[model samples]
Target: MDEQTAGALPVFVFPGSIDVIFTQPHTHKQLVTLYNPYEFPISYRVLCTAPKKYSVIEPRGTLKAKCCVDIVIRHLGANIRSNIGVPDRFRFEVCKYGYTEVSGRKDIAVRLVENASDIARQASLDQSNFHASFPPDGSSRLSPPQYAFPSNPGAPSSQSSPWLAVVAALACIGALMLPTQGDMMPSLLPTYLHLSVPQKLVAAYVLGIVTMLIIRPT
Candidate 1:
């Protein structure tokens, strides 16, 4: 253990720089180990200045004295295409807490490199990976109807229409009266209950649309 005295405060020194290589396709996963040489346990945080493309595991954690922790680096396939020829530079800043006087900061630069052949191979692999991760089944795949809006010529003007506001206000009044109004409820309940499940569902959906249109700011 190497000890350095910084203005009377004794600091335990450890080796800092760690180099990591991430080859395309085959070697997408890489691990970095950080060792603490101090007698007491220390808390540390690992930070990177990369975009959402990179997934880092165990970036921040506590390390026991004289023990080491492994940080996993996974390159997301979505962001890898943008960093084909150029190296994706990630500066890892490991800062130690507890000791305010001593600046226990370690800076490590991890470079993600890929050759032309590797990039080509990874692209195909990424496509396959994406498909495998999200299977084209009803459970995993989202239907277009879930996200798509109704294609109506009158939709653009509906927002400004006073009729839409009236319909929305009626829907709100109906919703509020359904639970409280006893005499009107019996007649209305039978109308809703007499309809098939699908028809009731459509009615409920239309009511939701009306409610949304009413709440939406003009």
Candidate 2:
């Protein structure tokens, strides 16, 4: 929705951009107040277009006429603690009741920080941060520090489990032994062959081990 066209609506969103700072594993909820100036009650639907991990608690609800309603945007810190440097953006489309089009929209920009201390340090306090300056000598000055989030070293990487490797090894060994054992025991081969390739391999190795133990009784 265009910001210029939003003024025509009877509803207004205070603090159009919802900014949130997450520093720990917990629930963080930010409130976005919606004011309805019409005399009749208006229903507003909040649509969040962002990662599934981030959610808007009261996404769809009605606002009383000539009153205000708070729309809550929430993020679970647990899901975000290990996701530093990943920015989550949400476009909230607020549509009026019975209207097929969006009446107003707000963009919620979320930045995940490693710690609480970084939140204050990364906040932009001056408008000058957006502009670059040059000296009278025509020499360019250094730009302001860019916002950076620390990576979580302890986060686990995507990898297969150790047990899966063991299972694969067992299956390979069983497959190799099946062909040789089947030749010696032709009658037994049919019974083993009835099973799938994987099943046959596992069964052959198990039976071979059992036969060796039985023959070497002590």
Candidate 3:
């Protein structure tokens, strides 16, 4: 599969990167969503560049028409100080339900951040890369224009730089990954993971501003 080339895959992936916090207990996991926007079912597999460093759940599966699958990827390596700042990546390959050949490919970076502020700064930067593009049928779990990717990235005459569908997706991923009111699921997430309604609202509002900054004209 690594030697194959693929055409446009109708699947959508979120966050653009999978970020795991480096800490003790090492229980935090990142969620990567694979969405099938087409009417037909699709088969997909996830591949990692650094296989020994992480573990993925549902690495291969079939997504029914207009459905999405959430992949749970956890950092499995020890917290090695020497590995900080290095990058890891995951590749997604998709094909029609019955086929073994690849139809399309998507890749996402993986980062292990040492602290909370690094995560915040990364999220802020991620939010400024939006351009809103919806699929043909217009049914989207995320109402924010399929995460707002610009239509063109190669047109020299265009004013706005076309980026991958992200920022908004990453912001939403952050919100989704935040722990809810439950002790059953233990995590390495910071103690301040809890948020009130107003606090959540402010977070959303701030993220909205970040999205505007990227989509807006310079």
Candidate with the greatest TM-score versus the true structure: 3
Per-model lDDT: 0.44, 0.48, 0.60
lDDT tens readout by residue for model 2, 1-218: 44312424534677645344555434355677777887766666553323344445455667777788776666544344565534454443445666656565444445566666655444443112312212322112312111111122122222233344456556655665554433444554545444455666666676566455434533
Best by lDDT: 3
Q: Write the per-residue lDDT of candidate 1 for residues 1-218, one digit (tens) a residue.
A: 22111122232223232222344344455566777777667665444334344456665566787788876655553234455433333332223556532244333333344553454544444433333322222122322221222223123321246576667667655554443323343464644434444544555677777777766774
Cα displacement (Å) at residue 54, model 1:
1.4
Candidate 1, residue 215: the lDDT equals 67
Q: What are the per-residue Cα lDDT tens digits for candidate 3 across 52-152?
A: 55666677789999999998776655366554545665667789999977788766666666775576675555444322221222223222211221222
Ranked by TM-score, top first: 3, 2, 1
Sequence-dependent TM-score of model 2: 0.44
Q: Sorted on lDDT, highest at the top, how do the candidates line up? A: 3, 2, 1
> Each model's RMSD to truth, in Å?
17.3, 15.6, 21.2
TM-score per prediction, in order, is 0.39, 0.44, 0.50
